[model samples]
Target: MTGDTVEAVSCTQLAYAFGETRAVDGLDLSVREGEVFGLLGPNGAGKTTAIRCITTLLPVPSGMVRVFGHDTARDRMAVRRLLGYVPQQLSADSGLTGRENVALFARVFDVARRERAARVAQALAAVGLTDAADRLAGTYSGGMVRRLELAQALVSAPRLLILDEPTIGLDPIARTGVWEHINAVRAATGMTVLVTTHYMDEADQYCDRVALMARGRIHSLGTPAELRQGLGERRRAAGTGATDTLPTLEDVFRDVAGSGLDDQSGDFRDVRSTRRTAKRVG
Candidate 1:
């Protein structure tokens, strides 16, 4: 792709403060168009904080973030129009039917009144929720609820789909199902997917490229294969045995990001920790 075709997401020296706590520090990243990219890190690595900034959920300095060339701070609405985000929390209202939940997002996205119904239907089908679309979301299993959320995100026809720990609480089979639908959608739309997950294996399997962030900085960025190969090359150069099993993404992550993970919730729940850190900063 030409440089003229804008990146799906870019951050240059991006930083954020939660009171005195620096959540994101001098971060630099670029996610190319039509690729499933991941910000893989454990909790408190500033992955969510960065996602929030990119999605314009939290304010950031102007020019620090851009979506498809539109400054997140300067062109908030325009950036919002290009992305769909699913958080770690449950989004599908249990009381509502699956279709209703997705329809609500369709309306929120302002899918033309004439197109909303069809769009909602299409999204539900995309996620394999057609058979259960009429059932109350509460009746569906955890995996189904996540799929419902995926459908809601898809209803908008977003160019970028941002999922924060999309499979956080589901079982292995369910996690696989969620990714299957995600892959199907990306295949059909060539959507640029920017997802965050603490699950290294998931990133290795689904992402075309990944960035390992910890302590608010990206320590590694590359395709999974490239990262594995690069680590092997380094090991060989350093006189390590060449016959060692090929390095996995996990090994690469520990090498670059270290073991400290931000374990706090990174939100109001972290107030106590935030205050403690902020006090230290002061």
Candidate 2:
């Protein structure tokens, strides 16, 4: 593909397994450059696993995973340099000041020593953390903390930003604040975003397009309105209720995943990790 047409992220029949269990299975996905793409799913739907593979944190044990046309497997460092990732778990150090946290990421991402300070400052400003940049992260509010993490991700000026439950434990106001910063940065830089969240409302409101995953595969993919309208049409045709109001994205999620979520739910370790992150962030 040409530079202008290269996909930000592409997974062709991607799959990953943990011994006896498969986390992601034959998943095909494409994220266009400069769009906010949401990967929506229940806890065990393999969104994180797929994200790990794309981020080059996990081996591409099966099919292809590419980031900006760079094969994740063959060009690990190149892919790493092109992307910034904020995982579900908190990455900020409570003892470190906000500026320090962002600076640390800049160093890790190999930002030039001369440029690191300026990049950190710019990242902090982008996330509205300029005032709090000197404060220890532990003293910041939950919302501020999330923004700090966003700043850490932004410090590298990556082409693609991958966020796994970035606003998972924040209050509504905090969530909105985080998203505003995210959008602002995207608008300014034309960065591609690949986010995974259980909050369907966030996906419906913020994402350009979404894919609903379940049982190790995507069950639906479209713009929020398109998926909701499709389900609404099927409901009307099947003589289900509610023709007066179009179905919400949550309704579409239920129609897609539903009770089978329990069957595919992540194991004990997943539960523990998720709760730990939520508790810390909350």
Candidate 3:
């Protein structure tokens, strides 16, 4: 895609701070249309902060952020209409049934009442939850809750979807199921997706391109293959002791981010470590 058609999302020198902590610092990124872009980072690395800015949940303090060429700050409503966001935390109302929750969002988005039913049904079916549509969200498993969130995000037929660690707190099977639905939605609608995840395998398998971030900065940005190739080249040049095998994205992450993968709390932290490592070795 040309830059014009491809520039679904763009951030230039984006920065955010909370008191003394610099949550996001001088970050730059671009996501193209009809592609899955993964923001891979560790916990406290500013992935969510960046998402919040792009979604217009948090105000832009220093940099420019545009969604579909509209300034996030000045054109907040226009941007909101074009984008759907599924936050890291479960958004489903435990007291409401799955269908009820989605219908609520549809109403909030001002979807026509006559069309709400079909829209909710379509979203539920898309996520393979039509059978449990009437079940309370609290009774659903972590994975089911996630799927419901995805359904809610899709109810408005947004052109751009921002998912913050969508698969967190799920078993491997459920994680795979979430990915399946995400890919299906992308394939069917050609919607641009920007996902934040600490799952290396998820990024490797699903994202067309990934940006590795650390300490509120982008360390590297490239396609999964390109990242692996770049790491391989560096390893080859580093000579025999670098590593015997081709380095995965995890290795590239470590080399670029200068950190090791340690078991950490929070799904964001887990995915971040999957992307960050101590060093790149041969």
Best-performing candidate as measured by TM-score: 2
Report the C-alpha lDDT of model 2 over 1-282, residue by residue, as the tens digit.
556799999999999999877999999999999999999987778999999999999999899998999999999999999999998778899999999999999999999999999999999999898999999998988778888999999899999999998987678988998899998888889999999987889999999999999867898999999999999999999989698799999899888877645644436536765677667865
Clashes of 3: 11
Candidate 3, residue 136: Cα displacement in angstroms equals: 0.9
- In candidate 2, how many clashes are counted? 0
Whole-model lDDT values for every prediction? 0.84, 0.90, 0.86
* Best candidate, lDDT: 2
Model 2: colliding residue pairs = none
User: Which stretches of candidate 2 lie above 4 Å from their native place?
Assistant: 1-4, 263-278
**Global lDDT of model 2:** 0.90
Pick out the ten consecutive residues of candidate 3 with the lowest summed lDDT: 273-282
lDDT for position 169 in model 2: 69
Q: In candidate 1, what are the lDDT values of residues 159-238, reduced to their tens digit?
A: 99999878866789989999999988888899999998766789899999999887888888899999999989899889
Candidate 3 Cα errors over 4 Å, as ranges: 1-3, 240-242, 260-282
lDDT minimum window of 10 residues, candidate 2: 260-269
